[model samples]
Target: MAKVIIYPTTSLILADLVDRMGHKALVAPEAVRDRVTNPEIKSPPLNITPEEPKKGLKYAAVDVPSGIRGRMALIGPLIEEADAGIILDDPGVLTGCAGCNRTNELVRLLIKTKGIPVLDLKYPRDDTEARGFVARIKAFLEGLK
Candidate 1:
């Protein structure tokens, strides 16, 4: 299993798509920003959406007071100190957002997402002709188990 935060939309889909795609998604904080954004950082490999979350996928949101002090200041460390990270070719599809727009945040998050024991899946966004892209994630996740 890999450790990382995903966006609300992405987080929700990730809930099910996670291990299903093949990775032990260590249930982390879903605290809107931390929960989702944090994982997004490390797991650059996940698929993210800017408009709305994918259906059937479920995720939690973290509720930390605005200002760096109340939030990441605490959780950020935990993520940094994590054992491993997950990254895919894409962050997923975009749907919607209440606070930050998916496109805007995704840009920053994409660059920010990185760490050790990375289960980075350098899969292509295209290729209906390929299956390894999906399998790579699954294989990585399975390794954890």
Candidate 2:
């Protein structure tokens, strides 16, 4: 089965779709679920762990912005390891904390460099667009197998 990277890694719909198509969906944030939710931490809002400089160095050794590095830590591995990808490019809806312009651009670049088949689609605004979005994704996933 192909390993597919899904952008907005938190999207339930995309993840389900990828699985339904018999492909393994790699959603980066899910990798760190334990860190984001801890029942012991009573305050529900503060989900993030403090950034470590050593971890940031993985994406860029010198002069790397912490935000990009943090994003890379979650996503870089998935992008590098993906056999295929689906990008839901939506600036309107809050995709997640990974919506930073520079970080989004960097992720796209990394996916491109991986030279894997990618299905890039904008987030649907209407029923017609939504249908097309689903169709396109289905087509892409099917093509992978």
Candidate 3:
């Protein structure tokens, strides 16, 4: 099954759709869970290792903000590992938000340039549009080998 990175990295609906389509959803909670549950990581609450920022350097410059670097550290690897992606633009408040514009832009750029099949869609404003949104996603997922 394809490993699909759903943008916003926090959209449960997209993740659920990917999962239901027989593909793996690479989302933030799973990434954080890996770090938090790792025996090698002694840090709690913050759940970040010193090397986390360093790993992020592969994606962002040293001059970038630590927050962006830290976030990239968690998300960069996911982008690299993604076999496909789904991005929803201008998402509604209840949908999901990356909370960092720089990181969001960087993530979108990374996913788009990843040389994988990516479904880029705009957030639906009405029920009809929502159905079309889901249908498009379903078709995309089903098209993946």
- Model-by-model lDDT, in order? 0.40, 0.75, 0.89
CA lDDT, candidate 2, residue 68: 71
lDDT tens digits by residue: candidate 3, 1-145: 9999999898999999999999999998888888888887789965897788788899999998878888888899899899999999777767776678899889999999989999999998899999999999999999998
TM-score of 2: 0.78
Which residue segments of model 3 deviate by more than 4 Å? Answer: none
Candidate scoring better on lDDT of 1 and 2 = 2
Clashes of each: 35, 0, 0
Model 2, 4-89: lDDT tens digits are 98876667788899999999999866656755676665434534444533465666554767777766777777777799988877
Name the 10 consecutive residues with the lowest summed lDDT in model 1: 51-60
Please give each candidate's TM-score. 0.41, 0.78, 0.94
Candidate order (TM-score): 3, 2, 1
Sorted by lDDT, highest first, which candidate order results?
A: 3, 2, 1
lDDT (0-100) at residue 118 of candidate 3?
92
What are the runs in model 2 whose C-alpha is more than 4 Å off?
Answer: 34-53, 97-99
Instruction: Report the lDDT of model 1 for residue 103.
Output: 33
The sequence of per-residue lDDT tens digits that candidate 1 reaches over residues 1-145 is 4554332323444445565755444322343444355555553432223212321011112332232222233234434444454544444444223233433243225324543455545435567524665566556556653
